[model samples]
Target: MAKIKVVLIEDSVVALEILQRLINSSEEVEVVGTALDGASGLQVIEQNQPDVICTDLQMPGMDGLEFTKEVMKRFPRPVLVVSNAVQPSDVDNIYNLMQAGALDFFPKPTSGISTDYERLKSALVTKIKVLASKRVS
Candidate 1:
């Protein structure tokens, strides 16, 4: 089967690199494109036409909420938000992102390059694959 293509939108260079590496490690998924901010993310999306979108909640030009809305209006892809703001305690943030059209959420690993990060790889890839199968319009 063809690997699922994914586009990543994150402002943090470290986080972006880590996410790309983690997602690429999965044989079932691949990071097709990446952008530092939501504006550039849209362009990448247009070019790649990925199966799923992984985005950070906070960005310089356009935040994930606004980005998700634009993406739904323009491209219409399953968007999985990977951000620290989506923690269970932040119900409002999570609800808003979902309301804006995000299909799912994954809390950004805070431990940097550590065991916790490594352990999250499977979960992250699972989320991506699940989202890839979702129908978003």
Candidate 2:
């Protein structure tokens, strides 16, 4: 089967690198593109035509909420928001992202990347695969 193509939108370099490594380690998913901010993310999405998008909620220039709206307006791909702000405690942020067209949310790992690698990788890859199968309009 073809790997699920994913585009990551995150402003943190370290987080981006870790996410890329984790997602790429999965045989069923691939990181096709990445961008530091929402504006650039839009460009990358246009170029990649990814099956799913994983993005941070807080980013410079344009936030994930706006990015999700724009993406739904333009490409209409399923978006999975990965962000610290999307924690269950932050109900408003989660609601806003979902209202903006995000299909799912995953909280950013609070501990060291390596410590959470195995579990995070499994969850992230599963989410990407599931989202890839979604039909967003």
| TM-score of each model, paired residue for residue | 0.96, 0.96
* Residue range 21-80, candidate 2, lDDT tens digits: 989999999999999999999999999999999999999889999999999999998999
lDDT of each: 0.92, 0.92
| Worst-scoring 10-residue span by lDDT in model 2 | 107-116
Model 2: CA > 4 A from native:
none
Clashing pairs in 2: none
Question: What TM-score would you give candidate 2 relative to the actual structure?
Answer: 0.96
Error of 2 at 99 (Å): 0.8
User: What does the lDDT read for residue 130 in candidate 1?
Assistant: 90
